[model samples]
Each structure stands twice: as structure tokens, then as C-alpha cells.
Target: MKTPAIAGLILASFALFSPACSQAGINLENTRVVLAAPSKEASLVIKNSATEDLMFQAWIESADKSEDVPFAITPVLKRLAGEQQQVLRILYSGKGLPTDKESLYWLNVREVPQKSREENTLQIAVQQRLKLFYRPAGLPGKVTEAPQQLKWRLLAKDGKPYLEVTNPSAFHLSFAAITLRMGSKGFTAPIDMVAPAATTQVEMAELPNGVQANSLKVELEVIGDFGGILKYDGAISG
Candidate 1:
């Protein structure tokens, strides 16, 4: 395997670690990787599920797609023979990242299949993209508490209802579902995730009949650090 460049790397939308094998027959042990300031590195297990040979190339890119990345990956490119697994380690630089909040990055692992011996056969190179989080040594609250610490409210723009939220924690919290619960009525908002110390607003779904907007409870399904879903009971601010 040769050193591959980040340039011309095709990326998939997004994927989580699962027991099901991928199109390229590659599987990751974890959905995401996290590196703390107290730690020097993190590792991921990459496995080739197929019985044939496959080439896997792993790389890191900033969440904002910045040119400068403060991390490096071991075995940037490797050939994994049938049903074999390899450990890919990610090393973080001591500096160049903000300590005030968790930084987000992407780990892109692309599977390069062996050249086709059959004539005119199609071979698709599959790539798996997972989220990577860089956390500082000391944060105000726990990662599990981030979802409940968020400030949620209902805002109106041009008579259209919108959901507004602010993250007070240094950790980035993602919401899989946000619902405004009322008496026998529920109006779900399409808002997904919010950044740390960031205020985000998204237009909510239309209010159902007989649903009162004055007293509404916020029900959030948060995505935790290890890819588990957690429930949060909250209320809108006055």
C-alpha cells in the first residue's frame, strides 16, 4: 500500500457502525472516535468482511473541511486479505485545537477492491464516513448532561412557528428528535443538532388542531457519545 492523498477522495453522506456488512465488505468496530486532551490518541478496528482481498485507505479531515488537520492516522493505506482485521490508530497533536469546546472531524475509510479479472464488471469503491470528536481535558459538565443543559424555546418568524435552541455545554449534542408535547398532541420539530455555545433556529412543523402553544413540553431524543439514544425531558423558556 502507498501513501494516499486526501485530494480526490470521494466521500459518502454518513454512516454508523453496525453489524451488517457494507457494500465493500468493510466494517468498523466503532461508529465514532473521541480523543481527549489528557489522552494522546485513539484507535479503531477496521475489518474486511469479505473472503477476497480488499484495500482500505483511512484519512482524517476537519469537520469544517479546513485544509489544516491536527491529526494523523497510522497505516494510511493497507491491503487486508480475506476476513482479516487491522487496527488503525489516530494520533492527535497537542496543540492547534480549541480547548473551550469539542472539535468535530471526519474519519474517511475507503475500500479499494482488487482489480477485476472478469471483463466489464463494475467495481464500486465504498467509503465509510464517521464522526470524530476532540474533547478538552476539563469541561464544565458531563457529555451525558449536555442535552438537558440546552436552552430550548419556541420562536415565531412571520407567523411561522420555529424552534430555537442554545447549547451551554462545551460538548456537542445532537438531537435525533425534538417534539413539543402538549395535551394529547405532539408537534415535532425538524431541528437535528446544535453546536456548543451556538444558537440555532429552525422552522417547526405546523401546529396541529387544538394544540396550545403557550404550555408545551419539549421531548428530545439525544444522540450520546457512544451512539446510543438518550431521552431528555425539558420545557420551553418563558
Candidate 2:
């Protein structure tokens, strides 16, 4: 069975192969969007980096697959000239969304390129998706501290080793990499995001014949603001 994150990624990959007029060139100013409380709106800057003009569409959807959304994006359709930029305004209606914890959403930007006059030429459109984080005011703790506060444990079930991670805080943690170190040997798990107040178990590779789980040290690199990675270290539970 595939995990939720893995399934979403598969679907996104399938979307890239759909029919399109041509390839588009664009640049997003940020990899993620953060909307804090008390602010009714947020801005995302998108630039058409190619020499030719391009048409684009932008929208927001719940990352959890919910139908009802609490936010709206302005100028859903736009035509930008080469080297031109547009500011996408995201406004929160201040309803139907949680005010106690951070909520996760996805912002999708699709580029529609112009068709070529030459026949037998294929065109491919590009779609970009970024994480959208809605942070409510007065959260118990800071987001920067949430990664280190995660509860970690190593366990064996059905003769297989697994690493369990639990996020107790009300902030979402997006990890870029997770490494498990035991003595001089180390194992790395694929990157994944742990939602606030949720738990995820990552299956580990076969351990050395005599190695034990309890002696391993866990290290994770989380995606931070401005596309940086923040490192955290922890030890497995007894």
C-alpha cells in the first residue's frame, strides 16, 4: 500500500503527461506560502521568465482532499509577457478553517504556452504545486521548535524494522531527509511530511545481523522558510 504522500505524488506526476500546447517557462518567488492570522490576505509572486509571452492559471485546494476551502485566489487567469511578474492575492474568508492549529493546502500554478505554427510538433504544459500553510494566531508554541519536539521510536514488527515518528505540536513539519545512525552504519529514509498531531511509520531497510534499533540516533532535515533546511537530532526511545 502506498502512503498518502506517495499517492499524491503519483497523481501529480501523471498530471504532467497530459496534452499541452507547448512548454512554458516561469519562476515562483517562493517554494511555500504562509498565511498567518490577523492578516486577511497573502501575496505570491510569479514571473514569466521566458522570452515569449505565456498564459497561466492559479488556484488553491486543500491538501487533505477536502472539498470545502476557506481561501480564494484573485486573477485566476492571466497573460504575462516575457520577464513580467504578477502578484497572486490569496484572501482568507476567516471561516470554515481551524484557528487553533496550522492547516495545509496546495497552490497549483499551470502554465499554458502558445501553439506553434509548424505541424507535427508536440507541446507540453507545466504545472507547479507548492505547500500552503495557514497559521492561526496564538498557537501554543513556535513552528521552529516543533521539529525538535517530535517523538521518535524504533520498533520491530513481523521481523521487520520500522521507525515511528509522532508530531505532537500544532505545526506541520516538512522533512527533506531522515537519517538513522547506529554505531558507524547509517540508513536514510525517503523524505516525507508529518502533519500536526499525526503519526507516521517509515519502514526501514534490513539491519545488520547483530545491530539493534535502540542504539540508533535519528537526524532529520526539515524544510524551513525561504527554502532552507533546518536540522534536528534525536535518539530512539527505550
Candidate 3:
């Protein structure tokens, strides 16, 4: 156990520069993938921007690795010449996913290690894992409108303030940032994501002073299709 664990740490320490994973030479065309239902298939382009050839592999896995995943990717292993790109076809089974709300998975792409003959050689193979959302057909509101449907409220406990976010829409709501605003002053914090039909309390994003008596205006930076950030406004809920 100790030998393997210690060797893992040493290998990770040398991964200071990301070349094959998500950095300069190799890259994914998009940051996130949205698999809309009724299509059952999606694709991603892996590009080798460096001048040297590289090998890549891709796969889809559950966010929780222990769980069984229902996704498969074609061309799982491929070698791309310099300045070339390859497409990875992602196909989802028709069943085994939530129909009422979006489900989360991870698309993992990694650089395959190459055999090199050199003295004391160490190779860094980094894997890029991105958020993949699978949306079944005929859910609640449109994803564009889901951001506006979020409800928010402020609660003070232990002399600090916390914001409770309730997502009413069936689509999973991803918030990049939250802003608590008084009339003149505002503070912002990063709230990564919130699930559909669920409530989440964001901490460390401190509320503005005088939140107890006043209904603070809340602003959210929501992630939209194409991984773009969009702003939406809502008020404190009761």
C-alpha cells in the first residue's frame, strides 16, 4: 500500500504542466456537453494542437465512480497526428436515466502513455473530466428559463448569513456566482451548482449587512447552453 501510494504522489507531482490532457497541445472543443433526449447520440472533438503526434482515449463515467454508467463512447482509443482532430461519438442507452430532471455524468478524456527509451523517464498522463448533462425528452421548463425560476432566501445562524437556493424547474440549475445586494452595497460568492427541485445552502458567500430586516435582491450568474454565463435576477423568498 505504501509503495503504490508513494509512487502515485511522485508521479502526480511531476504533472505540473498539462500537455496531453487539456492544455496547449491537446484540448477539447467544448467545456461541457448537453445530451438532449430523443437524440441518443452526441459527439466531441479532440484536437492535437502540438506539432508532435499523440494518442488519446475517451470514456464516459458516472460522477460517482462506484455507480454503473449508461454511456458509451466510440473510438475510445485513437492516435492523432500533429495538428489533427478526432471525433468521439457518445451514445446513451434509451433507459436507466431520470426522466423528470437532468442527470449528471462525467466525460473523461486522457492522454495515453507512450513508450520512450530514455534514462530515468517519467511520463505525465493527465485526464480531462468535464460535466456531461443528459436531459430526457419532455421535461419541465426550457433550460433558458430555468435560471429565472430559482428561488432564494437569506438565513442568519451563528452570527453569519447563509443563502438558501431552491430550484423549482426540472432542469438542473448551475450557478457560477451569487450576489447579495442591498440598496447600495453587494457581495458576491461562487456557488458551483444546484440540483433540480432541491434546496442548497451556500456558505462563505457572506450576506450584506442588514439582511434580516430587508429583502435583499439576489443576482445569479447562471450557465446556459454552449457553456456561456447568463445573468438572472430574483428576490429573497420567505
Candidate 4:
């Protein structure tokens, strides 16, 4: 089982590792990348904070493993000196992608450190992945409002409790954590994402003993525009 901290680090676009971890030498200026409508491309900035020169390779792939994504990254491979920064441009081909809703992709940045021949020493390569959101023209609601537009409900299936969440808006709702409160008892669901105009169910576990699922209040901490987590509160529908 994965801990909440580890799961958050994986789903979150922001860098969660501390600077004391020398392996985490590359710093990203922005945690989330947004390509708005009427813009052909978006840019991301990466910096090398370590004293040694670092080699980096960046690429883009569909986060949901969809086929034929229409995005490309420039300067696929490069070397950055200490305290130096480089810009990565993501150009959209405007093909094989939807124009009615926001699309999601993952921007992977792999760091290769120069190998040392010293005995009894270890070197580790670091790979960072961030979210890339492609926004089309004229969506129903703003991306920032996605969390508030989610529909939540609690149901029992196969003798177990499950939380049903539906996203009615045109923006993807990526949640960092979800807390469901019923009277004096509360439980947190794992991190997950609900696609635009889609619904997903999460199995509830570790719930308080003898707690009822009906009339539960829901609180969600969702990923924001700048990679920070924002809170939203709502009640579960019957």
C-alpha cells in the first residue's frame, strides 16, 4: 500500500522533495503547464541548482495513455550548467486532440548526472513528471471552478462503501485528497482524477466504525492553476 505522502508526491506537479536531497538538483519554475486557446505553444523553464553540470531530456506523453497525442517538445536533450536555466517549448499540432474540452498530458523531465569513477559511491538519476493541460476555446466553465462543480455521492456496493464522483464541467478535476465527513466520523479517499464530463468511483476504506454513508459532507483538496492544492466543500447527494 502506498502512503498518502508518497501518493501526493506522485500526483502533484510541484516538487515535493527537499533541497537536502542532492539528487533533486533541477528546479522547475512552474508546476503545471497550461496551453490556452489561440496560443500555438507554451513554454516551461527549468534550472540547474547543483554545482555539477546536468544533462536533461524532456518529452511529452498522454497521461491517460490515449493514442496519437498532438504535442511536441523542443530541445529534447540539453546540458545545463550550474545555476543555468533553459526554456522548453511545447507546440501543439492542433490534430488528434479534442477542441471541445481540456486535454491532459504528462511532461517528463529526466536528469542524468555525470558518472564518477570513485569507489564505494552511488549515483541516482532523477525523473520528474508534471501535468500539461491543453485548454480549448470556449469551455463551459473556468478550470479553476472544476472542483466546485463536481457531484459527489456515497453508495454501498458488494457490502463495501464507495464514493461516486462525477465531473459535469469541461475542465478536468484532479484531486490531491478527499475527506468525507459523517457526523463525528470522517474518512479520506486516495488521490485520483475525474475526467471532464465523466464519472469515477473510489472505494472507501478505513472508515470509522458504525458510520452511516448517507448525509455525508465532502471536502476536497484539488490541484490548482499554479500547482497548489485548493480546498472545496460540498454535501453528498442521495
TM-scores across all candidates? 0.85, 0.87, 0.83, 0.85
Residue 101 lDDT in model 3?
92
Looking at model 4, report the run of 10 residues with the lowest lDDT sum.
1-10
Candidate 4 lDDT over 144-187, as tens digits, reads 87787788877777777777888899888777888998777668
Which segments of candidate 2 are over 4 A away from where they belong?
1-23
Give Cα-based local distance difference scores for all models.
0.79, 0.79, 0.74, 0.76
Q: Which segments of model 4 are wrong by more than 4 Å?
A: 1-22, 208-214
Task: Using TM-score, give the best candidate's number.
Answer: 2
lDDT per residue (tens digit) for residues 1-238 in model 3:
0001111122322334543332336799888898998999988888998777888877777765645778888887798898999988888988898899999888878776565444344666667777889998999669999887887777776767777888888887776887877777777755788877888886544555445635578788887767789998887754
Write candidate 1's Cα lDDT for 1-238 as tens digits: 2233343343333334432223477899988888877997999999988988888888988766678888889989899988999999999978999888999988889887566654444456777888889999998889988887888777766766777889988988777888888777788888767888999987765764333456799889998777788999887863
Q: Give me the displacement of residue 61 in model 1, in angstroms.
A: 1.0
Candidate 2's residue-wise lDDT over 101-165, tens digit each?
A: 88998888877646665444455567788998999899998889998899887777676777889
Residue-pair clashes, model 2:
0
